[model samples]
Target chain A: MTPRLTAFNVVSLTLGFAFLYLPIVLLVVFSFNESKLVTVWGGFSTRWYAALLGNGPLLEAAWVSLRIGVLSATFATVLGTLAAVALVRFGRFAGRTLLTGMVYAPLVMPEVITGLSLLLLFVALDVDRGFWTVTLAHVSFSMCFVTVVVQSRLVTMDRSLEEAAMDLGATPLATFFQVTLPLIAPAVAAGWMLAFTLSLDDLVIASFTSGPGATTLPMRIYGQVRLGVSPEINAACTIMIGVVTLAILAFSIASKRGLAEPGRAEGA
Target chain B: MAEPPGRPAPLIRFEGVTKSFGAARAVAGVDLDIAQGEFFCLLGPSGCGKTTLMRTLAGFETPDSGRILLDGADLAGVPAHRRPVNMMFQSYALFPHMSVEANIAFGLRQDGVPRAEIAERVAAIVRTVQIQGLEKRRPHQLSGGQKQRVALARALVKRPLVLLLDEPLAALDRKLREDTRFELKELQARLGLTFLMVTHDQDEAMAMADRIGVMEKGRLVQVGAPAEVYETPATRGVAAFVGDSTLIEGVAGAFDGAAARLRVRAALGASSPEFVVAAREAPAEGSAVTLALRPEKLRLWTEPPEAGTPNVLEAEVWDLGYLGDKTLVRLRLPGGGTVRVSRLNASRRPEAGLSAHQRAWIGFDPADAVLLTR
Candidate 1:
């Protein structure tokens, strides 16, 4: 049943949404301001957007961030899916509880600590901290998120489907690829998108691990904001928000279509 | 149980198989054999180890001890996919993403069968199971009966040596279940393949299975043809579990070679009626025993039979259940014990010309009452 929209409910709903979205709305509106000042709304113009297009270093940083997001998210999804299947299906093996705890530990770990430890590890190993190091750091931190998303789906899936596949003469490996993977594809896709967004927006870890030519968009934006905010920065932020929003929308639509099909992901 | 005469060597044999989960023993030393071309059913209540026994054969579970033989070859380390056996799960377990045709062709594809042969076999099995028009539909889009047919087709497409069905008809409605039982039996007969099914419904087992093995508390208590098991249950537990029976405990009074007289020990009536039942072995006098009387076997007489009629007891009609096809009359003995008698409603008369608390005589032939010593 739909809840009744009482006067109190309407007031609370309006207050909650405004509290969450007011600052973002203001930022979006000011991105189109004709004034060079970031806050003043003299008039509307597309000049800031045009100026953002001409910033070479900013554009290069954005490209670096996109590449890192795609690569790390792909690696994270593969590793996280394997970890989830092992945890869920390998009932009561040695170190099971310990492995499960370690797999999820990164989700709750402070980003500063994760970043500081990775920086020390790279320093001690004497390896160059460039694109590969930043990608690896992002993968290590975002994989737990992917694991959490995919693990919940795996836990609720009907185990009998896999058993039926094996009974029908498919080997254990074949069953996982044919029966189990297709059923959990939507959750895996969602996890990939989540990791991609996380990597795209991460600043603390990227700042610590990135070196030389591996500057990400978030680090570049933070550096520019510290110097002094500009309308070009606002325009760049608006575009970043649009990209993240589209990613979220695509993930939601894909998952909703998965939910619409009955008996695809039902719990045992 | 020894192998039945005139049959070839058993197709599947469980040699003293036992399985335990932690402290709970699911199956305890079960030894059974199913011959080729026979439909065998494991009949028991839930957790009685019927499903566990079947899973041991399916290779989903490992027995703690003993061996399983298929066609005289020991199957100890064979995995489920490598075993030449297919199972139809109770839930049907159709892959929801795959279409009906894809689901049916899954097994043949695994075997690396030619693509053309896979299509032909899938089509043949679909037509055999009468699900011809549902080739492109997903599992969720089909009804329970339709999904059941697809599951059957998938399991049969590969033509396994033995087909294992775990409560195959349980998911269907009552009417559909009854019809499917006959169809499954007919299909098994035409294919001439061994079909081992696990079910708790005794009526279904009796209607379809050539032989029924009754299990209780991790043990196979009795194994026989349906008629034999019903007519001569090995113990009181089998007698009570296989069908509805009123067990009257007593002590042996006399043995006349063909039948034994049991003097009722329970105060079933003021007269303490003596029951005579046909028995193969004579029990010593005063030895404890029990008489199992089936509801349908007892005849409810408005008037007492001829004087000195054997196995006759005087009882009062406690209540009646008119169930359209038959009327069940609950009769109370003088000593406050109740026994049920089922009478066929052969005529259009709704009543049995009897009312509650009315006097009546219930009699049965000596052969109809099974005497149990345990």
Candidate 2:
């Protein structure tokens, strides 16, 4: 049955969404302010957005962040999916509990601790801390989130499907690719999006691990905001929000289409 | 274990196969053989290792000890994918993402069969299973019965030497299950493929199988035709598991070797009647035995039988279960023991008309009562 929306429910729902999105809404509105002061509302103008085009360092940081987000999320997804499959399917091997604990430890660990540890490890190893180190750190932490997403889906999957594939004379590898992968694609896609977003906005880890050449968009924004919150910064934040929103919308639409096609075919 | 004289070598053989999960044995020392083109059923209650035994043949579960030979070739280390056997999982396990045609053609594609031939074989199997118009639909788009047919078509398209079905009809509704039982039997016969089905449903095994093997606690207790297993169960476990039977505890008195009959003193509390029952082999004199009597075998009489009538018992009607085709009358024996008598409702008018608390006389032929010594 559909739930009837009472006055109390409507008030609570509105309050919850307002609390979560009010700041984002304010920032988006102020991004078009003609006045340089961020707090005061001025006449609407696109000057801040135009000013965003000429900022070389900010654009470079944005480009770097995009590359890191894509590369780290892709690598993390592959590694996380493998880990999920091993944990779920390879029944009860030695030290399985310890491996599972280590895989999920980063999820609950403070980012400060993870960043500090990575920084120390890079220093002890004498490896240069730059784009690669930041990317590695992001992969290390975000892979756990990916594992959590993919593992839940794998746990609920019907194991008999794989058995059926093998019983039909498909080899184990073929069964995995043809049967298991296609079934788990949605979870994998969701995990990729999560990891990508996490890597994109990671400031503390990037600050700890990155060196002279690599500055992520979040790090650059933080650096700029420390001096003073500017309309230009608001514009950059608005653009970031727009990109993330568009990506999520595209992903959900693609997944819904994948699900709805079967129903449509049945109707035909 | 002995092969029939005229039959050829068995198609699949499980020679002393045993498997255990941790401390619990699932399939313990099961030795069996199935002839080609035979519909063999593994019948047992749940957790009796019936499915585990079938999995051993499918190469899904390896036997801890002993050998599984397929056409005289030992199947040791032969993976499930390479085995010349396919299984229709109980859950159907139809690929949710694949179209029915693609699901059916999966095996042929794996073998690198030509695209044209793959389509041809897929079409043929689809037509055989009578799901031709639904080829483009995915599994979730189809109904339960349609999904079942697709699962069957997928397994049969490969033309494996043997088809293993793990409770294949278990997911269907009761009416559909009944219809599918006959359809499956007919399909097996028409295809001339060796089929080994695992089920806990006695009626399904009885209706479909050429022979049934009754498993008990991971061991096969009896293997025979349905009638043979029901009428002449090798052990008390098989008797109790295969069908509803009233087991009367008794002690063997003496065996008349010439007549092939054994005398048993039943242990009903007050009126302990001595009965002469037919048996090929008798337990030692005075050894405890159980006499398994099928409810339908007993004749219910409103009036008492003649004084000299053998195997007759006097009992009061305890309850009446009015099944559509037959009525089961539970009778309370004079000694506080209970036995059931099933009377077929040939005429629609409630034949005996005996209500609760009414006295009735029940009797069965000596041959109908099976003496189980195990």
DockQ of each: 0.55, 0.46
Error of 2 at A137 (Å): 1.5
Tens digit of per-residue lDDT, candidate 1, span B36-87 = 8889999998999999999999999999999999988899999999999999
List the candidate 1 regions with Cα displacement exceeding 4 Å: A264-268, B1-7, B258-264, B267-272, B283-287
TM-score of each: 0.95, 0.94
Native contacts conserved, per model: 0.65, 0.62
**Interface RMSD for every prediction, one decimal?**
2.7, 5.7
lDDT of 2 at B121: 90
lDDT of candidate 2?
Answer: 0.91
Report clash pairs, candidate 2.
none
* Interface RMSD against the true structure, candidate 2: 5.7
